[model samples]
Target: MTSCDRFLLDQPGGTLNHIRPVPAALFLAASLALTGCSQASSSEASSASEDATTSASAADFPVTIDAANGEVTLDSRPERIVSLSPSATEILFAIGAGDQVIAADEYSTYPAEAPTTDLSAYDPNVEAIAGYEPDLVVIANDTNGIVGALAKLDIPTIVNEAPATVEDGYDGVAALGMATGHVDETAEVVADMRAEVDEGLAAAPQDRLRIYHELDEKLYAASSHSFIGSVYDSLGATNVADAADKQKSGYPQLTEEAVIAADPELIVITDQVSYTADDVANRPGWENVSAVRNGNIVTVDADISSRWGPRLPQLIESIADAMASVKTPVG
Candidate 1:
């Protein structure tokens, strides 16, 4: 699996492994990086596949599409859909497929109506999932091959891999639209997202602003290549973590000294932890950090900031609002 894939599968319940590129999977799957345990959640559906039967629409019956795991062919419009990814659940509900959704993995928490359950996405049990008698299953294609395992049970699965950039995120949304038979709604959702992001970022200053986006209190940062980094890139914020040569994977662990040296003028914290801006200010020798000194530390909604789904524009807007308080970085 790719580094990004590995990053998505890791759930956040334990201490971050500072030695390597910790997945921060918890950040993607759930909201906070502090939650070390990988928990499963709920599900959703999109509108593309309407109330069409297999015999009536044989040509469209087996809608085959290539996904992260491989190609999956849906025999007919799915009446019972199970979404393993939270982002997917949001897309499904946004695209008008919520009615068809029967069961969702634990983390699909948005829309309130999603069938959130005890189903674990991280350690997927084929028997438990099969018990739902779902005609279609959507996944995030992390370290484990949930798709492959489902195939053995003659179950149909589609893998919606995480996007690397904002544009890629649009594509992922559209692909989900097609899989769920909600093509038009997906397009509308994408257009709405683009407009919102464009509006959110339009207020960003032309001059670059160096920023440090904290994934957790452990100081793990998202490089310019990650999905969240792309949002920062859109708002013209330079990621201080990207300057470190030690970072290979998009999510990199930064040394306290490196962060202090970068002196980012803006700090965007993605989670609420015991550590606070006061903790940052009190760090020995970190008193001069531009963000801390200038009081530019901002805490964004952890769930929206972490997931690269429908709420991306909201995340962008929040970051932009935070940026308004800080002065442009000066050389």
Candidate 2:
């Protein structure tokens, strides 16, 4: 099955604006939806009352946070935290906020126990999420007007943008840790991730090998500026997209001619569901490419490679292993 489109919204024309590379919902509107039910039902009313009481008590709050939503003030430690971003959810759980996370968007399938809801990060229904009674909601990508909607509901939110570099990933983890009162744990997690990356790099082949990262079967590629490219860089793979003749988005569409000419030594295909090693090799002119001729194309789990969170160590190791396993290109 095709990966669910995360945050992209259709424009007036047929063209698609590629949003951030994660998750599909924003939840402040869900809070607004719950307001109506709380008034009509006794149990709901009690829950709402308890939430208000908690907010009023202010347990070591209001914590002022600077995020994509600007400065957000939290009146208390969030008891019911909803995560709309998969990466944010992963980070939250990594920093020991899993017990506090009451709900997450449909895409947060990791950790197995994350309360995955029908909520769409891209088409978030405010009432649906508000019903969960979240005190705080964390979003990785807010391209779908979620921040403004949550702002209108007076709901606290932390917007974590997609990381472009490994350092950015560490920063995101640190921010989520601070938000969830798990500062030290977050630091430890970041340190561990950094160490893993360093180890992967240390073991990477000293000789540079040209690589092409397949974002999709359509030949869309990730440049060095992308998170995947950072991983490949750590493994000492020279990304051909970074040296492409035609420049486009960080995730660029490469023509068959261009890719063939680049003659990448290794092809890392993230869209494994659609393409296999043989499938890639069978492509019309791909037989001439060094990767295809030498069977150097590697298929990776899209989930592990795409999401930037605690699993980054796994991703780095996977790429490094692929690099180590590929046969030397025959001249």
Candidate 3:
């Protein structure tokens, strides 16, 4: 199964770009097909209409936002918002814009109250999205010229692509809040996330722990350059995958020998659909590894780990907890 995808695009020459990591062979194919279809971003229309607004200051209406696609102006609060990006959907709801959302993509499954439809995030149908008649359509990754198509129909859309770092994530959250006319709410959310992350970093063990983050069973790993890896880096944890990411693609495929050589102190499994911590421990020669010997294995939620949404605090907490759990810290 695939994990939550990040805002990062595929590396040149067709490398896996999704937040989900897979074997090198699999990554090539998926990445080649995954992000290649994105077309030119639509500039979008300015000045939202009444149907576009729900609950917002009248002064806030006719607001203009500079986004990934282009400059988008909302004349009024967006009462009917169609979210095609799961990350965006989460931010929308977290910033008090959930009530304004009319429909969301299939993968936006965080808030049970969200009106999740069969609309595909991977293969979005412009007609289906437009059918919602939403005044504001928000998308993350564009495919098949979705932005241009929507523009052709005079449907205003905003491209709030994925963030590559925690700060970028915060920016996106703030942007969404402003977009939905919840400026104060977005500011508070960012402040809270910052406080939680800072607190988590403060709680990290003084000794630097070598971390091996298992993206999947195929042994695809995330490097210090990766978004998830950035979290570990902030915690003062060392990423063993940094060595494997020779090209600095952030995502890399590691051989068994590479994993053994790294000999990480903590093994963080991002997804368990293909294998479990026990399965990793049982791998040939893995039992001799420091993490395996010390029973220092942490399995994290794939959804929470992958998306850089409001739940980002939770991921940091999980990693910080793992760091705190290392009883016999390696010298």
Candidate 4:
């Protein structure tokens, strides 16, 4: 039969008007046999693939990941780890992987037990990291030349991208869990954190108070895309800068003129910044700004507020308090 005729004969809903009954039965039996063989082959292949993955997981082969910077794989679990960022260090501890961390950057002060490892000391410090004989290094920031230098030294590094939003933070916890072989523990920690945040939001004031986050004396502020902006949005507070056009690059500077125009009801500053409520109030034209005049300026711990790590719940609470205290209207 022609291809079109064969196709019509094979299809249940197709034109079966021209087929001889005996020939059609024979063709259907052959087709069924071929289909059965194909399905059996596919099932075997799938089973084999699954077996391979299971064997790989059981063997715990040393694997390196280049996407997060050259993180080296070790046979079985890593016995020694070094963290390059405070956030990464915090994650390691949070996931019950703290026992694996042998060293940490000087600033990895949380949990009170991270070994102090100086980034400046490593040969470009890659050799020194080798001297520490670490099985893995967790990098939270890639701005420094460490990522490239570590690759040259054949060291394993895992670079963590900072979580830009609340959901991203939860995902980060899970990623750390998988990387450190502590998935169950990490899930528990994430669930607890999410519950805390949800409760904070539930109890937060209902009014959409205008908020201004001040990062420095020059009025550097977070855009709608920043971590702080995410916190404000979660708490139902209105970030005055949310409407600003510079929402792409994270934090952006707002001119004094613009600040005066926005006239936020609440101003939040980081401890590292020199500006305070009095400073803003004493500014040449800021005296009339409702936030300054009404003393609604609050300073937050820079490390907790700026770092996107385990202390995020505290950051959310601080923002909630600032918003709750807003009792002025900026013109």
Q: Each candidate: what lDDT? A: 0.68, 0.68, 0.72, 0.62
TM-score of each: 0.79, 0.80, 0.80, 0.74
lDDT of 3 at 5: 36
Q: Candidate 1, residues 1-331: lDDT per residue as tens digits?
A: 3322323532011122111111112112221111322233432111111221111122344455556666566656788999888888888898778888999988778889999999887778888899999988888864366777788888888777767788778767755655666544554676678778889889777668889987766677887877888888888988998976254567888889999999899987644445776676788987789998778888777667767778888888888888877854456
Candidate 4 RMSD computed on C-alpha atoms after optimal superposition onto the true structure: 18.2
Pitting candidate 3 against candidate 4, the one with the higher TM-score is 3
Show model 3 residue runs off by greater than 4 Å. Answer: 4-58, 327-331
Stretches off by above 4 angstroms in model 4 are: 1-75, 120-124, 243-247, 329-331
For 1-331, candidate 2 gives per-residue lDDT tens digits of 2332331110011111111112000011112224432122356654543343232222435555556667666656688999888888888888788999999988888889998988877777777778887889887667567777777887777888777778767656655654666544554566677778888778878778999987766677888877777777767778898865245345777889989999998898765456677888999988889998888989887778878889988888888888888897556
Clashing pairs in 3: 5-19, 7-162, 47-75, 48-74, 48-75, 52-77, 52-78, 52-79, 53-77, 62-75
Error of 3 at 192 (Å): 1.6
RMSD of each: 12.5, 13.3, 12.3, 18.2
Query: What is the per-residue lDDT of model 3 for residues 1-331, given as tens digits with 9 covering 90 to 100?
Result: 2432332321011111111111211212222222342122222211111112222233546656567777677767789999988778888899899999999988788888989999876787999999999899998877778888989988878888766667667667756765677755655666677778888888878778999987767788878877788888888989999988889877788998999888999998856356788888899888778899899988888778767788888899888988889756457
Stretches of model 1 off by over 4 angstroms after superposition: 1-59, 245-247, 327-331
Residue 320 lDDT in candidate 2: 83
- The clash count for each model shown is 19, 11, 10, 7
The C-alpha stretches of model 2 lying farther than 4 A from their native spots are 1-60, 244-248, 329-331
Residue 181, candidate 3: C-alpha displacement in angstroms:
0.6
